[model samples]
Target: MSDLPILIAGGGIGGLATAIGLAQKGVASLVLEKASRLGEIGAGIQLGPNAFHAFDTLGVGDAARAMAVYIDSLRLMDALSGEEITRIPLDEGFRTRFGNPYAVVHRGDLHGVFLKACEAHPLVSLRTASEVLDYDQDGETVTATLASGERLRGRGLIGADGLWSNIRKRVVGDGAPRVSGHTTYRSVIPVEDMPEDLRWNAATLWAGPKCHIVHYPLSGWKLFNLVVTYHNDAPEPVAGMPVTHDEVRQGFEHVSPVARQVIERGQDWKLWVLCDRDPVMDWTDGRVALLGDAAHPMLQYFAQGACMAMEDAVCLSAELAGAGDDLEPALRRYAARRRLRTARVQLQSREIGQHIYHPAGAHAALRNAIMQAKSPEDWYDAVDWLYGSTGLEGAVSREARTLGPE
Candidate 1:
């Protein structure tokens, strides 16, 4: 086998998770980050049981669990009438049924779990300000060109670079990401700033007509992560741009006082014009492969962007470890295992935004009726394909994990 390390683009959660996952399997990896520092930008992200499965596989389960703020349920509310639509209880039963607990954590904390593990591991090397521009592969080895015109060689290349990936341009050749025309605003406030009556230990979503609001406790309940989105038909991509509270309130004026108050309490709100891509079959080329947002960017409706990326890392590291010198075939196997699953997520995220979250009048009524009729068991079964499946069987640790009520 060549002594060259596998090169990974980007240094976000997915990149670090892949680096650590590879190290756990005795494979070495070099993470090339475009930024001068390695960190996460978001506030909070929901973790399905599938994310926990991936965590264990990547050897960061315990660290991740320690930092997470486990919620009791996924509460869906009608923003118009301020009524309960339905809730999926993430209690003991849910954990036992899925072999892991659903929880919410600060994005930086979760990233730290993987980053710490990667830092401690001898097989992983981290580099900042090293942007991977494109690559050249000659069967046995792949050479990556950086933005500064420097070149690096590796046995294989995995593009974990996010949404605007430089590697994807060379690998998939698909045009720019499809803009969803949805503007999302996010903020984090002290727990005290949250409405006392609304302080529930759940991942709460107030779904309305062409808009929605989500709030959950993060960072050990020290902060509340508030994310609210509206279909304003934004024409271009935007990220982390500061917006006044009044601009955000314009979209939620119709929502009930209870549902709209989240936006009122928000401080220093930032905006993100959402975007995703139509799923494509090919994300791998020879010794190069794409992971995370680079391969399958999706709307945040399903809350599985980071989770899917970690899951990809699990399958990818497993394949690479097993394949030895055959990195091309290894990447092909990795893409085969992940393609359909990621595609399902990508498509369904858009569906959820339209059908469940943003419908109005008759559509909203139909959504509420159908969703309210489901029992916890039905909800569990509906998500079994995502949280429990054969896709992660051999990759995850079978050892049962136990957690106390939060």
Candidate 2:
């Protein structure tokens, strides 16, 4: 079989970035998205140093920077008293230290930047409303079948379809992800409508036992993106699409009035059940491999979900560069290099959730005291291994990895 293009499932950030990265290396890839149009929910995300590296490497850094706001400071506050406990300034020095600025952007805006980059490349093609059913490999050629019965051949497959990935089920035999007994409610409110005090060029996090709240400005300060996560004992999942403001308020009533005020102002709130998988050693099955949430689903506590996915795209393309003559070695290398790192991130994020959200009496008191006494920079230092990663460049030594498989 002649060299075929890579088939990528899912059209979110990871899938699109993978397409752009592959195209930049003169490799061909096709993106299959189940949705008729690519759009994200009304929410915001924090993009740290590692994600910036992936954006720059993929050639979308300029566009993303233009649309995103650089968060110059992050403040942690007591949810009950509404009083600041720590303030971390993120200046040029911080950027120099981290190698990239910590920025925040609307989820849709970030996805749009990646989509534009993919659209410009000749080697990248996108097919919307096309759902992939399964894939089978024959030596060098991998064939993927869509639900519509259309078949497409490719050299490899990257399942970037996210947490409910159909491809992941086929590869790992469908085990349910662990739910942490928590649910998140998210919404975007008009900045002008919010209290003027809430408008800041920083991410503000209010941490409490069994609940926490994160708020930051978006759309160039035109809107405030708010997210509230709380523990729940209910056995059933929260229902209804586009959760109403009433639902958001009810979920956070146990929180401070400041938290209540933020939720009350949200008119277009949405809810999601937070779930994640324990990292697996096996993310590859022959020519088909997993990427992003499909490969290593993580809790939102660390805010590295999208960032890790973007890093995966960059590393996968780099590993497969110029391997058109042979496919097995390159695909295996990608899987091996990514599995450990992603698994660690998944585990760390889960641990952070338990520590940050479910702290016991002493643990909670100690956490509060540390936040007040320690420099916020110290907190960032603790996560340097995560935020400072340069993907494959940091994961594997370039000079050594060039020799191919060990």
In terms of lDDT, the best-performing candidate is: 1
Q: 205-226, model 1: which lDDT tens digit per residue? A: 9999999999999999999999
TM-score of each: 0.96, 0.93
Clashes of each: 0, 0
Q: Residues 34-132, candidate 2: write the lDDT tens digits.
A: 999986655899888898888888888889889988887888777776777788877887787888888889999999998888888889999998888
lDDT of all predictions: 0.90, 0.80
Superposed by TM-score, candidate 2 places the C-alpha of residue 44 at a distance from the truth, in angstroms, of: 0.7
Q: Clashes in model 2: which pairs?
A: none
Which residues of candidate 2, in runs, are more than 4 Å off? 234-240, 358-360, 394-406
Off by over 4 Å in 1: 390-406
